[model samples]
Target chain A: MARMSTPPRGRPGRPVDPEIDSRVLSAALEVYSEVGWAGFTMNAVARRGGVGKAALYRRWPTRQDLFAAAINSLRTSGPVEITGSLYRDLTQTANRLINRFLGPHGMASIRALVDAKIYPDELGEALDYVRQSTIIGGRKIVLAAVDSGELPPDVSPSLIMDALAGTLVHRILLIPDTRRAQLAANPEPLVAQVVDLVLRGVGWQGTVSTRRTESGSGEPRTASEG
Target chain B: MARMSTPPRGRPGRPVDPEIDSRVLSAALEVYSEVGWAGFTMNAVARRGGVGKAALYRRWPTRQDLFAAAINSLRTSGPVEITGSLYRDLTQTANRLINRFLGPHGMASIRALVDAKIYPDELGEALDYVRQSTIIGGRKIVLAAVDSGELPPDVSPSLIMDALAGTLVHRILLIPDTRRAQLAANPEPLVAQVVDLVLRGVGWQGTVSTRRTESGSGEPRTASEG
Candidate 1:
């Protein structure tokens, strides 16, 4: 369905209400989770948010714009802060990411994006934005470690980022529901193992070797031990 | 729509033609790729295959059954064989997987399965079969390496499987088309990098260190290095 052709100009239109804007975005996320991208519509969102269709159209010219806004709202809840130690920082970030992904809102957004791949231009751009902000954001932490010599100078931040984020996403999307429930209950062990793998894979010399020595009872520590 | 309530018995029915059976399955795949799960139906498949609705219903009983059979047909292309060297084995398996996934039929099947998550029972079972075969098949190669002591005794096959397969799938599904095209052009370099990362992460001591020496450079090799 096409919206009004006239674009709302700054001076000619009434001021947009911030409260209504937030409400519409919230409702958009709820509707998206319930129906996914194929069923997602501006009409449904407007109805759910108790706003006029024209008001929804004025705020977001297209469904893709509304979807992006909804995703951004959900993403703003947690801010990734660097805690100095690469292991600690990665584990915390990964844990937060896993929690968000397993949540209903995050799961819905991801499902929609995955389905949106058929519409290359719109969905592709939205996917790229999410990857750049989230996956690339994670890469910055690894780069910080490389700069500080916590990891070898030759380490590829992009490759490390792929391995870390890739494994987590793979498990979420491909694994069974029971296994996913287990992961959601406690992601710390898996996060620890993934971080350890990245650290060792990058040839980091500090904490891993130290931790290896501490667990020197020689029974062969599990991948998550250190 | 409901099919016939009575289950067709083996002895009383007319002989089923293998040629017609294969044709219907092939047509099912094409229809699925065109419409995805949301629009998939037995009626469409029958029309596409040029078979009567009664014939199709008698054979498959349900859409899920037909969907499962179609997926199974696509999965029978090649079998994975181990070549002893962990790097060689993993690289080969990953390459094959990437090729299959990049192909039209593979992409369609994956897209349908992802969308099928909401169905949670019938389609979910079909997805589980694919994951067990493909992902678990990759795991067998790692388990072999561990058995031969090419990797450390303590390496977790599951974690390594997740990292290796996860990175490849992540790149395919999440990355942009240009990057995917680059990967498809020469998956060898990327596969080599992924294998190297997995080998190092699992603490393999032999070929990796030997390869490092043969390169003859004094600089330390990154995980992405061959």
Candidate 2:
């Protein structure tokens, strides 16, 4: 049994050919987006990539390997680079997260992975890769903000990240009318709104003096001085 | 084609059997939690519910019908009663939302629905049921808080509700370690944390008389407090 099952073979190399792997990854994304994870398979991916099954298998011996490679490729696709401003940094990150989920590749792969999470170890590593690289990247940006003094150090970065992302996800998943572009259009407004709410809720010692126009409309003044 | 379709044989005005439908919903929940949404089917639900497939079909007619009925049951599970205090009311709402997601029925259903949302229509309705019910209940609580003066009168209840629930969902989905029991152990601390954060973020004008303690010893004073 051991000999017959002896390690499935695949291509081995240092600087592996990006062209073949990239083609496979993109094709895998296409197939997943079209049919979702439950419908996705290596065979389909191979067909989509227009490569021989043997060649695809040689590169990724298991389904998990293929998925991992795809997620890794996605990570590289729009790796967030910080510009040191929390507002700008977060706005950009939110846009990226929303864009990915709304796109064909991101939506399909996400659907597939979520479907597979219930049966542990079947697609566990790939699921982990997806969560950490994308979802957790959202967390990291919040953490970076906290580390800087942009946010009050007292608040939990994880919770804030969850709240913001959750609201977006909740809207996407539930509200049929809400599109990705709508979310992207004003990501900063919601971010700013929540950040302010949370900071005040936490009793952040920072005093926010308001400078409102005397429009007499009685809107709570914007921060006169941060 | 018209004659080929089976007509409803049940007598008119016959009350639907609640007991059988309830049993099926329970069974569906169990199977979906164990096997996931993709693998769940009416036949499987029938087997687990201990009813004849014919009996299930007589009531639900299709997988979509069954899923929809089960989700509707979840919607009417309970309501968050308004207490006279803002803090207490908001805290209770948060607690309920957290409990629902972290609780056995709520979590499993949410997990299944998240998996199902990738597909169109049938599962989408089930997912939407979960999402909409929570948001509705959440908005009610926020409105009560505003009326009771716990929150500022001008505070946007929808935004607050979305942020509050969204934050909790994020924790449940991404940070698996935050369990129902932990929330139960001391929801007040988390509530206090969230409320404080949110209130501040909203720019709610209030006197900051209480000195909220920091969780750890890391230069305790915020820049503005002193």
Question: Which tens-of-lDDT digit does each residue in A1-226 have in candidate 1?
Answer: 0111111222224538989988988899887765666667999999999999998888787888788777766666444665556776667667766777777665565555455556676566665666666665676777767765687877777787788877776667676777778778888878888888877777776663332223345563322211
Clashes (backbone N, CA, C under 3 Å), per candidate, total: 0, 18
User: What stretches of model 1 exceed 4 Å from their correct place?
Assistant: A1-27, A30-36, A44-55, A208-226, B1-36, B43-59, B208-226
Location of the lowest summed lDDT over 10 successive residues in candidate 2 chain B: B217-226
Candidate 1, residue B99: Cα displacement in angstroms equals: 1.2
Candidate 2 residue-wise lDDT, B1-226, digit = tens: 2321212222233338878767878887767655455566888999999999988777777776666666555555366675544455556777777776655565455554455545654466555555556566666655554443445556666576666666666555554332535665766776666655555555544334321222233422221100
lDDT of 1 at A195: 80
Tens digits of per-residue lDDT, candidate 2, A1-226, equal: 2321112222255326778878888998776655544556889998889999988877887776776566556555444555444454445555565666555565554454444435445655455555555555555655655665556666666666665566555555554534446655655565565545544544444334322233464553232110
**Model 1 global lDDT (CA atoms, 0 to 1):** 0.68
The residue-by-residue lDDT of candidate 1 on B83-128, one tens digit each, is: 7667777777777767866765655655655555566765777777
